[model samples]
Target chain A: MVTEIFFKEFHTPNNGIFLRIKDSLIKTRSKFQEIWVVETEGFGKMLLLDGKVMLTEEDEHIYHEMITHPGLSLLPEGMRVLVIGGGDGGTVREVLKHNPASVTLVEIDELVIEVSKKFFPSLAGSFNDPRVKIIIGDGVKFVKEAKDSGFDAIVIDSTDPEGPALALFSMEFYRAAKKILTQNSFIVTQSESPFYNKQFIVELLKNLKSEFRYVKNYIASVPTYPAIWSFTYASDSLELDVPPKRKISPTKYYHPNMGLDTTKEIVDEVFGCS
Target chain B: MVTEIFFKEFHTPNNGIFLRIKDSLIKTRSKFQEIWVVETEGFGKMLLLDGKVMLTEEDEHIYHEMITHPGLSLLPEGMRVLVIGGGDGGTVREVLKHNPASVTLVEIDELVIEVSKKFFPSLAGSFNDPRVKIIIGDGVKFVKEAKDSGFDAIVIDSTDPEGPALALFSMEFYRAAKKILTQNSFIVTQSESPFYNKQFIVELLKNLKSEFRYVKNYIASVPTYPAIWSFTYASDSLELDVPPKRKISPTKYYHPNMGLDTTKEIVDEVFGCS
Candidate 1:
């Protein structure tokens, strides 16, 4: 009898999701984390960093569009964007949709980029765009030393607040990030799940609020992640509770009037602030 | 050494969610299905029917509120309401918040009601309200034999379209349900997950559209369920796209201007309609 292989990622020590693996496509150790590409019966191909799901072919669009559009749609066209830790290139693909003049992707792990180029060409295809630039370095260091007031938007598409991505969630990184962003620019970060990562989100929001004049949280449902994935939008001058300034075409989930303001009350209720 | 126990519910044969059991509170086989109540590490107490998760203490509000308030809040206060297969009383509890003149709950299984009253008191507490009339019978028969245009609203809180709940998702059931609803009345049903149950939802929406003039879909994120859960609202005279006619207080998720129209576009995209 043949044994079946399954990939299990524990959200907590006791609870988690499991997918039936049809084949193990690739497995390797990167400098920062363990990287694995597995073909699954339910979600097609999935990429895991440190054994935690980074993105899956089935539901990556939800997470990618949510992290990119809400902030980018509010800004003018021909903007400059900087993406942190999205080595898979999904965020850059979405940023390219908004007609950005330039996009600089800072990914610490070069193996992730290489693996995506081989396995997930649809995502990695964005790297070939003339406007896009790839920076093989730590995002925190790039933000610290980069020219001031350079980018119109900064999208932190990092992993959970751990490993190399831990510093991306810190206050000091936000400060350095602020120095590199143009006036009226916005920074959006994947803020973990609203249900499972409440404490992390509460702390992240507090730090963002301290640095930005207008900080708001929005959510999208990503099945591969811990259900209700959240993103935090922070800016000093941009209004967070307005409709999209322009229409984003070819979107499966994100819509212009998709109730961005509804999340404020939900954030307050989840944190017991209201 | 002690062996650990966990409860697993598969959305598909290849994918599923698992929760560690802190304690097995209750386990028994009912005439209709297997009933199990287990104390979980992540979602507090959970009620399972036939090894499938029915509800969890941590996220039941999201499901119950989305299924109940969106339809009930659109109608006037003190309206007559009918709930089908909601033996747990959670839907009845949300319906009472709308100040319904009377509520008639028809559930096929009596054991579910007894178990809910014993273990899920917060949800079962609505049974004690004076306006509620519990009918221990099949929902399908009740809807068939009931007088024409009797109730102002009908909320279908049955399980997925399988086994004992299979008939509830049929076109005959929707046709019969429409006959029992008064003019300008609304009928809402839990339509399952958009990601995992796309084919089911497409068929359900088609049946609903064939029976009602206005049919719309709405979504809420319930972490315990399959991420994004869907609900469909159907009406003959009432507009399904308008805002909630009244406020629903003590809600953790639903808001009046929560962009009900957004789901229509999502439904179109998911089913490849537009």
Candidate 2:
């Protein structure tokens, strides 16, 4: 008899993606969530948290570059950055490309970092740079207790809006994150899929609108994710629609011509705006 | 015991999407290929050909609008259009929105049209329009036999590049399509996924480039498809990079601001162009 092993993630109770795995590289329960590393024939190595795909080697550049470049591009050089819950270091890897003064990554789970360092060294290598500071703690608490007006930008690269990462999606968290940002600073977060998570995206955008002077939503296609993945950009004073401050080279997805603007029509349709 | 039913499509030998089905609406073998219509929990009614998803009720707007508007929006009003292999009438539905003088749709399978009339009335309703002409025949043969300089635009809304639809993606067919188009006319075709069908897209774009003076590629997110879906536009003299000739409204996905421009970076990466 032939044996079959597959990893599946359901975006809705009824819809999702499945991948045939060659072998399980690692499977263990972390302090915060269940973690699994699997090798696949098509996508190379994949990292999953709580059975949800976090990143795969083949398409991780699209997600990491998209999450970092749009926000960081508007800011001046040597900006101080904060990344919450990106234990795998892909966000930091992209941030470092912008010549940041510093990047402080606060991740609750240490095991994810260790696993990524072992399996995804190119991404985890960002931790070795002297400009990056790694913090193993609750991101929400760190933001609330941090000194005010310190960081220039905040990137919430957490998991989906559930489990320990649930607080990261709340308005209260957005307000707390705002307190630590210098004037003209921005906050960007993964706003989930527009197709499968419409309710979540609408609610999250509403919360961001309440907390910021300008709130915009942009999207990129991450094939491993549920659908077209969305991102929320919130800022107080930065001009949202302008060319990047400078060119950051060596990117596969996020180029200056790439359409990273907030698609207002999509927002209007989702919000039922006439 | 409770039983479960699923509709699954493998994008590759190892990866794909699956949706929970409430019930199979219809299953039949056409003269060309296998056809199945199943009621899905999240996606509503879905049509499958040869065990591959053709479209779903919930997100079909994205695919239909993207495939039609980008090219049609550039053409002048009262222009003639030809659509190859779009039996379901969704492409015709969008083409009519452009106020074309007339549309000629050549689809090989008559049953696909019959099924669409029964199951997807809104899409098939375009067939009732006096300006639209439906032809049940091979699209390749029809394009070959059609009078020269007849159509202002041609939309190839065919299945995957296999089985009965394989000829549609070939250069021989594209050369024949060009013969039927008026000068300054354009041709657009659904070119499959950028991630899953990279080889096919590269090959198709190369063929289009060989036949047309200018060829470009654009992409849109079709959640039910394998990944981010791609489309190719080929033309002789139409300026591809200007604002659409006119506003085609009441669209959920295609607006003037939507990034329909050929993303050269993606093409460069796929073609290994420096």
Candidate 3:
């Protein structure tokens, strides 16, 4: 391993950012991909999957609150929620804050959960909640068989559409998610960087519009990420303009007014998509 | 000189991002600071002043357009303008698109102008416009003694508030700027990154609020910057809600609808400042 004052940049060959690592702790290969948890001087503990940053303790709230709150805020109270590919438990932690009846986390890699349990106990601790169920299987397969009427919201917190997470952004997966969502339910999936993944987002919006009645794109600026991160919100029945039914706690970034402002910017940027 | 495929990141000591440089081209020390012009694979030609990325060909439009358009759109018609510290001439180019009666650019460094003319002809070409008067002098001193009744818009496009540009953000300078402006005139200044320079921005807004009746903050996501780039709009008489008197062409990012949306987000994040 190369040790220097500055750490290796694990970004794609095209464009990338750097982090200063205080120490190298865990590095291992899982069945799905390579996993790492390193201590970063600037961003705290950072989780890396297949050499790409998944979460850092410092800015995870921005991603978690952004990915979960907007969709949950639009839904009715007390419900079952499904999270695909969020093995770190950050998304689950945010979802549970809303007092959901049940939260099912369908992460394909159990190794990610183990890493989180070891290096990120606070984040992974949510898995111990009585109402939480941990599933170690392919998210695509689980969503295919989910019941036709139970989930209030589905948050697809998958990595970039590569490796094990490729199927999560497919038309087949959106159809499956739509099938399992109850009336007034919504699904929000992590879209990649707007600067680098414009074509991918353009295609994803096109696919979602065909499967759902109303489609909205929301954006958040994650400092650890390359640029601005985006989330796609799709629903057939829920009116997005409707105020959030309940306020979730322990959030540092997500608020209704701020979310609405972001919504307008994202919608205008992708206006032609819908 | 180190020459390789990847470019060194000129970010701050605490945190920073990298750009893929095709080659290391120009590196020189001017009277003001170190200046560099390099070709990057992702962002094209980039200008770096004092080991910091200033602007790149790919995203310069986002910065120039966002800095100039919102304030210009709020103005009445072709009128006199003042630009402080925009030696690259990008801001002057954007200002010219509005057909202003005349533009007075006050840049402290003449070397910056020469470098831009040699390396960034497209950006610096606007200096040749008959309406432009390039003044090589201190911005703070120039604003303090400007004539009592001519300028309709003042754009402070300086670098960060750490160096010679320090005085530009002071309450004294703002008071001086307000003294020279016509009734409907407004001033817009680049306020640095919201994520990294929050405290600096908070202090700046406080200082401006002391001098201007209507103070509004706006932001734009420049992909190359640390995070979101911010601009401050301050006016004593203009109703910011007034629709733009005329349209400026050849803009890639700035539109009235999008500008309003960004204004909402920026204002909300800094609401606690006041």
Candidate 4:
């Protein structure tokens, strides 16, 4: 890795934005399919893969908040949680904050995890905890075995709905997801932006609604993500919302008082939930 | 103008992001320090200046919808409208959909309009309507001449708080805006994204609240914007949440049915509006 890359400011109507790509790299690694830890102005340590901003190092708060808080806070305390395809350990780190009994992260790619450990020590720290189990295997198979064992909440933090990750979004995978959860359990997945992929999100929502009794979609501002983002939460037991039961702690982007009630509002607008 | 500037793309997660800088070939004429357009995949065009994305190309529907509908819809039948700084013409386009008696668009940067006319025909076509007026001047000065002329709605579609356009976000400018409207009239401005610029939006909201009793904030999804954007709607007689009476035509966005209610909800959330 002997490459050198730099940032150039762009014309924006919002805030300071930057782009991080590989030029000539002196220090770079092949993790996941195309993962890179990017640093930007105002926002810090962002993760990028295939030139997409995966998670910002500075403001993982929004992603983590929307992902972890909505599901964990709604479930009973000390529930079992499983996260699929989160190699950066950001999802697991957020899950740990909820004080879950056992948190397992099954990531198919090992190099991504190794890269995260090397470049992102803070987020990678969650993997070192005893309560957290790191499994290197196919997430689909892992979910099958884990389904028989029983779980409370499952969050899938996978990549895009293309490439090898395509199976993650299939109906078969969702069927497995349904069987893994215990009664009164909830499942959350990162749906793409409603702007560029409204039809895609609509189809994803359709599939999810077909399986779950309760389904909801919420939007969040992920500067790195396309067309902002729509996150989907589903369950047979409880309604998903933006209103939070507990106060958020140590976050850069999410506010605890904001709650998950907003989640319900967005979902209501999605398919005319009202 | 003879020479052209080029932007380079960088790879992130699953997107191609672009950045711009001052080039010897292309000359920038704006009084602002610098301007850039960050181009990213799936997300819309992002604008940056001095290293920040102030506005992006994509996901502008949200901001444009909120800015145009509430103010125009609130007017009496056939009320005239004057839009300052909406040279890209998206706001004017939305205003035209309302089938107002007449509309005017004032923009300073002919270059921006020209660029849009070339690169973005959709926004440029917003200027194609017969009833719409296109003016080239500083909006701060243009409103003073139109006082004797009554306008049902006046929209300030300009940049953020700093530069020659800084005054546009000020009380004095709003006072001019107030003078341009008829009785029971309204105005709207592009408030920044709450996720990224809460302080800036809050400060602007405070200033507007000080001048108008009916003041509120609304949100939209812009992919390239630093954060999903929020806008401020203000009126003299009617509460901001109350839908204005109107029969606007079809729009790519802003259906009067859901549009009106969506604005109200966004206002309720951002401004603590009742």
Candidate 5:
């Protein structure tokens, strides 16, 4: 007897790596397109293009908060930030929350910006802020032209090692970053989930490890992404203005005190997996 | 610009209970049909029903390893066990690994038996044991009738509270549970996540306070479940089994040691929510 069955795979948001499994099967009209989205089902969507995960939805707070605060928060403080590939604009929004001098958001995809602005209202707020500058452009080429700039912090919110992000994962991009960043600048990017693409993440971490002494992997829960994703941070100086335990106000995400506490779990999962 | 957006609610399977959440428009492609079969854009599909979350493409051992081992490891002495609503019986298979005396499986749906025999090869092993007794009937009603029918432990593996479970979450259900067990019988059910669900869980716990002397919430990380959906254990006379500090077994879902350490966090979230 032949019957229809459901085969679902949990995957990394960055590459096509996934763990596929069966959830359920029913003989009926396919009324709904999807089954159900549970907390354990894992967040972050995986876009496998030519057998590679293109994007995983990093937790809105963990990745955005980490990418923005770690460097911007350390600036003694800076007012302006330039973001590349964060068409989602979540990182940009986190940057402006610090009351930055200004934010320049250079995104290649208008659709991503449109989607983030629509679906993720809290994240899109960064683009709407007067202090934010939304510029639709290529980050790799842009970084090269903006060398010796005085931006307080520069965040790379690109996708994984595909599309426009191919160059961002390379060292030339880091060298370009060094050219544009301030004396004690910070830089971070989506490093992908460890479960599906540990090799890719390790390679990225290794390359960054070779380039910077302060490169570190910070983890966070992304229910949608496979194995939860991590962000890689790199900088010249060790001294950073760690984000306060609490933000100036309340947030649905990013409780000030939890900022440092969540890092421990990140370290455990990372090293344990390693 | 009058660009419209959509936010859809989904009911995902977490063991038995449904983990509900509202997702925004970016999730245009459905993950799966409503039968707990998830079909995401790039990750393909997975079946998440029958209280077990196994990848459809991969073997069921991964999810089975975590779901069964964690609870069993906490109580190495468990012998006589009763599985509520496990018609497919993968859980019993995992339980049998410890070499228990007998396993009473109460499945409400008859089709589950027919389907399990045909589709699920790994799970069918649970029913093949000589010590296993299959009862095709209502778990809640049968349990109510099993007065003084002491069992070493009970695993509640029912479907979500859609229809059959309408009575499982009531005062009468727990009332019946008190009668069908020995003193040290540890009863564990799939508790909802503390994240998107605080108020709902608080109400359930509030009700349990009057029925059981001790009730504790524990969590396991399952990608299908957010932050790993929680589990609640209730006891009347004997001390609840404590979780191991380290995992003796290599499990994709749980290691033995995360218990008690995370107790405070789980308790705080459950109690603090209300």
Candidate 6:
């Protein structure tokens, strides 16, 4: 039986990559962006927001674990955390592994959360945890109004620095985020790709250094992302060398050793003494 | 006025990626595969062989320098080296940086050499150096019949472990290569992506281990490849940690520190104690 398959294309700014899809399970345009979940051949289920791939079932662990665990691992146990624009719930799932005191996920789009709950059960299931507080509002506005000296860590799992997510990358947003973060706290965010987004990464790193005492850029080679993705971690009073006492179980991609080594090696390449 | 542009697509086995090409400068069917030279917007010029991208002007230095330098750095001055199937001459260019006594580059296809010389002048110009000897023949037969205990390094710069290059990844090939290497000689070859070609990497690693005492796997995040490309470094009696005294000048990517750090970090992640 030779049956042909259709490919679902995800366009990058200059170049693009595509995945082979068996069927499109869900496709709808929300007030914020277009959302789709499709069953793929080798990559398993893929989630797309605004025609850009956010995660695939096979390799989501790389991005989710890298963004959440590295920054959170620097803090003590039972820490309060904030996640901005991670409506898909993968961030929340990784956060639960740390046994946080409470996790507040501030997503602006209600439909993104609703669609994820229906289509991505494995990721969205963490929402039912009693420690999670889901808020449907702009992350920028919410950070400004949130009480100061609260969260121990903040994970910005937003989309690319474009459109609605543009403000999230600005210095003003980082200042607001700093106001709410407890001393010795850190915030980790997806910067962009080094090959495609070098300028954006440079400006973001510079801006982060202006607001934080210690700012470092880390990198991960995610298959789905199809490029060397850059991540930014900023801390005012905390040292990020401390390893996590807790275990991250059932992970396909990350180990504590791999994470720390990646951070150290990439930090040197991006901001080395030489 | 708004304008529309066409994209030049390069399809992988199961999926694909595309770039915005200003024009397809050259296209021809070589004896072994199809060849292309395209001018891309973001990635400079791109070279495609058999419908798969071989290298781009933007990031080819990452792969070429990593493969050639780390292995060559271990040897003393004025050493003899052999390169199997590097038709493009990029590997030879990096090998010259160490001031080797002589480099014998054995490529199977003459057309590939000719095409690269015509289109990729910066890469193929190194062939005119007094130290290089270009041979157009079979690399498999070349290794099997080569003299024993003469060369300080052997670099297998063939394509993926398929088609004519299949023998380059076999146990028989490594056994043949092992016979000709000097006591402290090393061999470095490109393994495929960890995400898409895990089985191939595992099998190749196992084969190399049977023949060599110290077999290490290293990875580099190359943008055009779009996957974390792995490279295998195998040596009979040498430890790869020794740094190079010679300076690699006019290099955009490779520094001694960056190279060592990349090798260390990737070696741990790929073959870590944990």
Best by DockQ: 1
* Chain B of candidate 6 vs. true chain B, TM: 0.90
Model 5, span A45-117: residue lDDT tens? 3222233233334345545665666556556544567888776666776776677787888876665566456
DockQ sort, best first: 1, 2, 6, 3, 4, 5
Q: lDDT per residue, candidate 4, A141-199, as tens digits?
A: 88877635378988989888888688888889888888888888988988876655566
The DockQ value obtained for model 4 is 0.14
lDDT score at residue B10, model 6, on the 0-100 scale? 35
**Complex DockQ per candidate:** 0.56, 0.53, 0.32, 0.14, 0.06, 0.33
Decreasing TM-score order of the candidates = 2, 1, 3, 6, 4, 5
Could you tell me which residue pairs clash in candidate 1?
none
Docking class of 2: medium
Summed over model 3, clashes come to 0
Q: lDDT winner among the candidates?
A: 1
**Ten residues in sequence with the least summed lDDT for candidate 1 chain A:** A261-270
Q: What is the lDDT of residue B118 in candidate 5?
A: 53
Candidate 1 to native Cα RMSD, angstroms: 2.4
Query: In model 2, which regions exceed 4 Å deviation?
Result: A1-3, A242-245, A261-265, A270-274, B1-3, B261-265, B269-274
Regarding TM-score, does 4 or 5 come out ahead? 4
Error of 5 at B85 (Å): 1.9
Docking quality band of candidate 1, CAPRI definitions: medium
Q: Per-residue lDDT for B146-188 in model 2, tens only?
A: 9999999999999988877899988898889888898979999
Name the TM-score of candidate 4.
0.71
Which stretches of model 6 miss by more than 4 angstroms? A1-14, A238-248, A255-273, B1-13, B73-79, B238-250, B254-273
For residues B1-274, write the lDDT of model 4, one tens digit per residue.
3222344332233223453333322224454345444444334454444554444455455567668876677666677888888766778777776778888888877666765665456677877788987888888888867755388788888776677678889898888788777777888888776665666776787788888887766665564454556777888787654334664544434444332222222344456533
Instruction: Give candidate 4's error at residue A177 in angstroms.
Output: 0.9
Residue pairs with backbone overlap in model 2? none
Going through the candidates in the order shown, the clash numbers are 0, 0, 0, 58, 53, 0
